[model samples]
Target: MKTSECMLCPRQCGVDRSVKFGFCGESEEIRIARAAPHMWEEPPISGTKGSGTVFFSGCNLRCIYCQNHEIAVSHLGYAVTADKLLRIFFDLQAQGVHNINLVTAGHFAHQLIPILRQAKADGLRIPILWNSSGYESADTIRMLEGLIDIYLPDFKYINPKTAKEYSNAPDYPETAKASLAEMVRQVGAPQFDSQTGLMTRGVQVRHLVLPGHAQESRQILWYLFQTYGNGIGYSIMNQYTPMPQMKDHPLLSRKVTAQEYENVIRYAKQIGIENAYTQEGEAACESFIPKFSGQPQ
Candidate 1:
């Protein structure tokens, strides 16, 4: 599944990654920013031990307010062979992490598939999680059918104009909707280990409430609840921290207001979103963003 034409993402730039870069700003070579235990995910994912997270470089979406701009936009990471990545997975699993979380990995799905299959064959018992921006093609998601156990995807926008203005992907609403459906089809419902309370399999859709986009957040919550009907988990995030690059921007220059977060949270409850997780107290602080050292630890 080498991405010779490089249509692995929604961009479908069609550039031969062997020669040049695609819209994701990445070549065929695998580049990773960090591989370590991450504790900031939803409780089911992070658990008490933490999720073994691998932060890949480059992104298909160009959100102006992206928190990980240093690696996503600037591509601050070192290259590693697929063999090295396989080793990193086992190393993380050995750390007793709850799961192996792959962050922003849609761009490298083709290359990572064989590695994932190999890891599972080699007795890697932990659940593999795909944490992604919602700008994914359903076809790309289909490629991950049996490989991924948990799907952690963001439902960023329900409005085309809002998606265009923020992530520069006007088709985000429809694209995310289709991809999310594919995710649900792959993982039927949420399942947890009865002993540890950690998620074992399923889809968890996350939505970060923008500072002034409370209505959009409400639309997204209502849409998820009405469409999926608690078939999947929901994470209503209140951690939209304004990056330094957005210091001059109008709407994204500041953190999400408490009222804005509360309104969305209240709407989620009113809409009968029972299987959900809501953030509380100082979640918008910059400390939540991980420090991206150039190489995997």
Candidate 2:
């Protein structure tokens, strides 16, 4: 949990973050690009109102097809103190959102642990979701044993070559597997509100099917279904929006085709993945991406 020689992520780029930047492209200080109620997540998480989402700047993975490359890569955000983040949590809770969703926040686990502890102590009662890239260190995830109520981590890749090519993380497959195991350990079972149907505690794994990676997506789905089964929830996403950065890349320059997405969905059905969520309509469009205005909406 030391930010001085930051090892909070699997990268282990031991640079003094206070004085230098790490592979995550962030300093010791926590930066937030956006804080608002998001209605685009899974139904249980977003509900009728929305999920109070805090988009943290900086990421452990460098995904070339990232839709939020503005904040994740460019780091165009203002710094916030622990007290400010604590207040943001309570303020979002006051907005009547179903839960507090922390997006891509595994890199800031050091600062978030204490801030989350204080938020709960100050009567922040909404379910807090740790929305991460799934390229996490198991030890770091263990530090958040009692604090987080829900986990929404992405299982981006199962092949090391694909992971390295897409996100520059070769160890992503093993790292994500271990991290997910730890998460399931922390949140034992999926719990839901009787009336609202909002998720109170559990883990939901998401996989975004890439343009030409339908086979790999099937592999990931098979792995998750085989390992966790109906013990956890699944989100087979088709919203792989091609960003401006991927214009030159042949494969990533285009959106996922309808047939490709349907094939993945068919495989999920074939594998008996009942407790899952799927996207409908034109999901591979930039319109679905949220705006990072650096101010809460």
Best by lDDT: 1
- Which 10-residue span in candidate 2 carries the lowest summed lDDT? 288-297
- C-alpha lDDT score of every prediction, in listed order: 0.92, 0.90
For model 1, the stretches where C-alpha displacement exceeds 4 angstroms are none
lDDT, candidate 1, equals: 0.92
- Candidate 2, superposed: residue stretches over 4 Å from native: 295-297
lDDT of 1 by residue, 1-297 (tens): 556888888788999999999999999999999999999999989999999999999999989999899999997999989889999999999999999999999999889999999999999999999999888999989989999999999999999999989888999999999999999999978899999999999999999999888999999988888899889999999888898889999888988888888898888888888888989858888899999989657
User: Which predicted model would earn the best TM-score?
Assistant: 1
Over 149-222, each residue of candidate 2 has an lDDT whose tens digit, in order, gives 99999999999999999889999999999999999999965789999899999999998989999999999999
Model 2 Cα shift for residue 36 (angstroms): 0.5
What clash count does candidate 1 reach?
A: 0
